[model samples]
Target: TSSPTLTFNDGNTIPQLGYGVWQVEDDVAEKVVRQAFEAGFRHIDTAKIYGNEAGVGRAIASSGLSAEDIFITTKLWNADQGYESTLEAFEASMDRLGLETLDLYLIHWQQPKQEKYVDTWKALIELKKRGRVKSIGVSNFTKEGLQHIIDETGVVPAINQVELHPFFNQSELREFNASKGILTQAWSPLGQGGELLESATIAEIAAKHDATPAQVVIAWHLAIGNVVIPKSVTESRIRENFAALDVTLDATDVEAINGLDRGAEGRIGPDPAVSD
Candidate 1:
């Protein structure tokens, strides 16, 4: 079955469940991405820092699928946050991805201390105007960072991808994004598969639904309306994670998962507020 989609503020729809290639090495990205495609994933999230766009491009080329059938998203590195630099970096990314027009492009981080996100956002705006990218957004942006760019350019981001999971639900951020018509996309949706996956609570819920803990967590993300991209290099795990689209969590299940939020302590990534 096909995964569901969420409409961005710009009217573009992204598959609610996407395949992420964060830690996957460039040499193996093509293989695993192709396997993800075979497992029914239509959206792929990559970044220049990941060093795998070329491999992803190769997979897309060899997948026997049309460009329109896939939603490709990549980001601008922190070092390239100036307007001119962002523009040049984008063209370089396009060359690596081998795409004439990209589906979505994002400023990877707010880099608030540098105070360049506003200008970087303008470059994305210019890309959209030129039809080089269909939609533009940001990742790891705080509410203040988001507002800064919006206040400057009067352009709200279509999406904000961040570290979100049952352990660190990011409810406040999610609420803020919703209030601004922005879609919240989850990065570490499964809590990186350690203790969070082994929790007795998730295990119980998984057993109740006859699904894996990862799937249950993913289902929880969907139940609450966040776009989720779970990553795995193993073929079976890739297929299993994609099958999460079929796992339906009821109100009780979702509430139990919601209670697992660990607030700031559960965040597994760099704090965007202080990140360079």
Candidate 2:
């Protein structure tokens, strides 16, 4: 199967299965990003806190592909969560990425305790109006948090990036986003390489399809209409991650995967309200 696509509320399209460079080191990010591009991945997700924006920029600049051919996303860190500070942070990130405009820029997290995310969202709207950012969204935001931003700003985010995998499915939150026009994007879609591989259901499905467990899990995500960013510094795993598009899941496969939803009670990352 070919790679799938998800059209955002803004009408722009992003590849459903993309490459993520969350913890990749500066020394390796550029090269790995290039490799992911060569592997046929058109979307690349990174963050300012990941400490590899400069490297990601180098890879994009040298990829021999036009900037418009790639869908690049980066985030503004929590420390930079005020109106002016958010503007400054966005400019700095663009400078590091060597891009005049970004495909997507998201608030890295909703640090509610500080109560500055609303201001930050306002700044993002300004950035969008200034033509410095093409699309804006949030990461690590709950349903309540998402509603708070929209209720305050009257702007529906184009996407919501969260930690989701077979073992910790976020069905209710995704339903809420769908109702509000925000596309659900999965960050740790494979449980950071742990639970996904250990899933009995995944292994059985892999056997039935003659595919790897990772591929089955990723295909399952695609079948359910999610944009997944699976990260890997290894060449083989990168190739394997891309191959997930070829494994088509049947109704049984879909049901088996859907049964994994953990309801309103799963978390892979710290709750932002108390984390800071």
lDDT of each: 0.95, 0.89
**Best-performing candidate as measured by TM-score:** 1
Candidate 2 lDDT over 82-155, as tens digits, reads 99999999999999999988999999998878888899999999999998988899988888889998999899
* Candidate 2: worst-modelled 10 consecutive residues by lDDT: 264-273
lDDT of 2: 0.89
The reply for model 2, stretches above 4 Å from the true place, is: 263-266
The all-Cα superposition gives candidate 1 an RMSD in Å to the true structure of: 0.6
- Candidate 2 residue 13 Cα shift, in angstroms, is 1.4
- By lDDT, who's the top model here? 1
Number of clashes in model 2?
A: 0
TM-score computed on alpha carbons, candidate 1: 0.99
TM-score of each: 0.99, 0.96
Give the count of colliding residue pairs in each prediction: 0, 0
